[model samples]
Target chain A: MADEHVEADNAEAIIARIEHKSRKIESLLKQYRPVEALKTALEGSPPNTRDERCKSANWIMVHRAIMAIKDVDGMFSSLDPEYYDILMKYLYRGLSTGDRPTCDQCLRIHEKLTERAGLGCILRSLSDTVNTV
Target chain B: MAAVEVHRFAQCITCHAWSPDRSMLAFCPNNNEVHIYTLMQSKWEKLHVLQKHDQIISGIDWSARSNKIVTSSHDRNSYVWNLEGSEWVPTLVILRLNRAALCVQWSPKENKFAVGSGAKTVCICYYEQENNWWVSKLIRKRHDSSVTSVAWHPNNILLATASTDGKCRIFSTYIKVVDAKESKTVSSSDAKFGELILQLDLSSSWAFGVRWSPSGNTLAYVGHNSMIYFVDEVGPSPLAQNVAFRDLPLRDVLFLSERLVVGVGFDCNPMVFAADERGIWSFIRFLGERRITSSGPKYGSQLSGAFRTLYGQPKHGLSNDTNDHSRPQGTVHENCINCIVPLGTSGSSKVMRFSTSGLDGKVVVWDLENQADLSEYF
Candidate 1:
């Protein structure tokens, strides 16, 4: 019983942390600070934190941050290349776990990034993943 | 302090316009209808709904003098709304363009209006008193791509049009039939009605926003390449200078004065640019750059936030743990600013305030004096 209580406490703490970070990210998005929001989201726990919920809040932040960038090419130029790696991870995880709308957002980011940077970024990312594996 | 009011309409505001008294506003919520709202008891109340278009309403302009509203839609139609006995009457103008009408603007004189369309031509419409209807004359043979923005010179005779073809052209819109007045202020030997007087190739990317100075001698426009260019009417042909900014593509621009301009776009913050005496334009700084930070939360608010976070309460329409709800943005606008309209009791060139509406469904009014004072230090 005591162990279960401790686990619940730990879970609550984790959730509170996630909520705090997610809130920060959402405000960044609403403020049209997508680059900053992306950085904050990547620093904390996995954005797909609440799987049981209808839609995980972190995924929504990721989706909206992507939407805030009106020009994907401009975003690519503004952000560091490594952020794209984090975005790709979000894309894969979101596609596998997110809802239809979230998945659609992920796909759009993928399409736009690919359209902007073309096949070079994708091919390079694929090769990098293969080498690491 | 500059008066700043925030209206949360909760839908994408495709476009917005203000009435003559500035007490009423008409905006399209990414729909076919335009909703007119009036300020009552310091709150906005819906006064009327002007509905007729079958597609998305793309642009709206309110003529303060004439007290008329002009709206354009993707359905390739334009309507003029005149309020008569509390009823808004809509008159369809013979636009004659086959493609979608993207933007519409009432000329400074209120006697004419210009409509930019996806058909690569701008329709200059004027009232025909004989038939008691509106007729349009096409300004063709210049823009090879869709006309995105059109601005009438302060003189009301010259029209400046920006297009997706990466060209900004100035045309003489002097309709001899409707405009019987002599062109005493702005006229050239070759500046005839519907004549393409000058064209400036600013960028290879799509040109989005264009504006003419109060003096009608200088023109400024923003391009998709994240650049703003200036063109001075140096004799028959103009000399153009451009400066690229490290930001997103500016969606709209408005001249605060002949030397200063404010641009807004996906950045959600208005940026100010200035032109030196040498006619060289350069980036000054961003206005309204301050943002709200969540660093210093009071103990009571944090406790309540914790409970709300634990129970998953919807804050600002954002549900669950997916998005932030209650946290306010630092900037005035929360999304891409689609339009900027100069506001003041005086003339357009001397507007002391300006209003901007964006996709985030927030309308924000900014004071020019405050912004100008702020930009001086930067």
Candidate 2:
């Protein structure tokens, strides 16, 4: 009963954090600052060992920002290398277990990344993940 | 009776064009390279690979008279290919755009071509004998968004452009040196190069394709709003009609005759639109046996379908193929049909057979003489 209480509190905290970040991302998107919105969505928090928060808020926000952004070429080409690792992590996860919309977004990002930075960027992300583990 | 022969490929064919004799086919596999295939001994064989672009090729146009192919790509570059002996030589046309080039087409005369770009401009390119290279002039100032498709008038001077900005525009691309002023009797005499003739607001939706009829007076275009619109300019006042079909957005439109048009897109079937002499355009019928609307669940059941999808369950067991992505079941094209080109003698308004390539990696030839109802024709 005590462990269950702790788990509920943790879930509440995650939800609260997601709500705050989602508001920031949505406001940025409304202001037509998609690049800034994308940055905030992906880099707002440190790398989470638990991907629940990362996949829930950040992933959806990133997808929304991408759909809103006019300069898809610019966004993909100018992404930080570290962000690709996060993207690939979600991409594989989404492909294997994500919902249809999530999987679609992941595939779209993969295509854009491949188009802008070449297959090397995606391959590099995979290798980085393996080396880190 | 529409005789349809479908050929499947390993990769999605983003665009396709046919050679003059209808003996060879050139198509882009949604990649940087364009492949040329020819049928020999009743089997299609890969003949050549035109590799020049560094990005996805969006458009391909084969000039029947000159036997040349012009291709445009997301790399912001367009190349004109000339067949030399057995190999193809690519001459890059200077489009001078920073964004992706979306569509390319050869004019009726084959002396020049046009390239539409996401940079909000269409470039009219012609060969310069002095420099021995192709050069382009910009038609900037009209389009506010990416140009999706372009069609040249049979007269070879008037060019029609469709854009994602919800507008279909006509421009006078009459180059004095290359094109003779034969069309001046029919078109406006005072029209100069880069002059906007007509700018019609199609819809709030992005316009996908445009085509000029053989007579050069009628224009047909499709939009993302699932609408097929036609503008008939033969009368004193131009008449525009919009037919909103209850289906997904159409991607391409081709004029089969003066009064008939075929549009294909996300529905994965070719649908016919016809116009009477009064210029009243209407949706006639679909050309294929695949009835997407009848088989697919109605919008009333869409909420339940969404709920089922949320649980990762297939709605009604029929929508299982939706997750398959490329291979859509029970259709001539497994995905959206992207390009359609007529196959017959040039300048003939009545084409018996036409070819279509789609995102499903299938190239199909639909014979109208066999498939279309002949009661009306007879």
Query: Scored by Cα lDDT, where does model 2 land?
Result: 0.75
**lDDT for residue B51 in candidate 2, whole number 0-100:** 95
Q: Give lDDT tens digits, candidate 1, residues B1-378.
A: 343777877467999999999989999998999999998898889999998999999999999888999999999989999999999999998799899999999998889999999999999999989899999889877789999999998778888899998888888888877565655654442467778877886576678889987788788898766678888873566788887654456879988777888888866678778887776788776666432122332333323333443343423433234223333333556567888988867555565688989887878888756654545422
lDDT of 2 by residue, B1-378 (tens): 363678986468989999899899899988899999999999999999999999999999998878999999999999999999999999988799999999999988888899999999999999889999898999997899999999998878888999988789988897777765364545554579999888887575688889988787789998776678899873346788887655556789988877888898866678888787676887776676534333433443333332442343322445553543333333556457788888867656777788888876889998877553632531
Q: Which ten residues in a row have the lowest lDDT in candidate 1 chain B?
A: B290-299
Model 1: per-residue Cα lDDT over A54-83, one tens digit each = 125555556666556666556666676546
Task: Give each candidate's interface RMSD in Å.
Answer: 15.7, 18.6
lDDT of each: 0.74, 0.75
> TM-score (0 to 1) for chain A, all models?
0.58, 0.63
Error of 2 at B219 (Å): 0.8
